[model samples]
Target: MRLGLIKLDHQQVSLAISKLDERAGEWALKCSTSVDLAFPTWESLKSQSLQAFSPPNQAYRVRSRFLSTRQGCLTCLRQSM
Candidate 1:
């Protein structure tokens, strides 16, 4: 993706992977790619800068609220009721 030879949007890649799953009703599909041995190591991974993005605390709170609501967790649901 970083090389840009075969560009794919995030959602497109995710959907393709979901379809590749045997549980998603497409059993025969599979992903294949040849990664060069020269590719960067996992320990060298670094996140993209997001100075413009919202703070971590704000994002964590939002996700927590959403999971609490949608997943019907015992504690969260009990608290809400």
Candidate 2:
């Protein structure tokens, strides 16, 4: 997917999306007064979110909190109390 950020009047911005191949890699294109680039997403958003907590201490804390909430949600879904 391609995401373009366009500048409008008085500091306003706009986003444009286009479909493209992931293997094509990243791209930068000039649009009038601004440059636009394509942002790529991995296969799993959850894995991406987990990776965002980089520092060991922070990652541990966040992982614990996320796992607890995820477990609760799974239990609720399974109607297992």
Candidate 3:
């Protein structure tokens, strides 16, 4: 299945789309943002990204206080997808 990967580092967050290789138990990165996101831009990016990167019947793993702030967004995104 395809997976959304959100990586949080000090003052920035990185987003990536990956495909999980069930047989190999590995994740292969498909695409990612070139720019790292700070708090000021995280919201817009998160919404736009979730919509664009998230497809139906897939999973996500977001790691960051920034993303965590909007739990409903994540849940809704999952259900919508």
Whole-model Cα lDDT of every candidate shown, in order:
0.38, 0.35, 0.38
TM-score of 1: 0.22
In model 2, where is the ten-residue run with the lowest total lDDT? 9-18
Q: Which 10 consecutive positions of candidate 3 have the poorest summed lDDT?
A: 23-32
**What's the TM-score of each model vs. the native?**
0.22, 0.21, 0.23
List the candidate 3 regions with Cα displacement exceeding 4 Å. 1-10, 14-40, 56-81
In angstroms, how far off is 10's CA in candidate 3?
Answer: 8.9
Model 1 C-alpha lDDT per residue in residues 31-77, reported as the tens digit of each score: 12411121132221112113223476877898788656744446655
Task: Estimate the lDDT of model 3.
Answer: 0.38
User: Which residue pairs does candidate 2 place in steric collision?
Assistant: none
The best candidate by TM-score is 3
Clashing pairs in 1: none
Overall local distance difference test of candidate 2: 0.35
RMSD of each: 14.1, 12.2, 14.2
lDDT of 2 at 24: 20
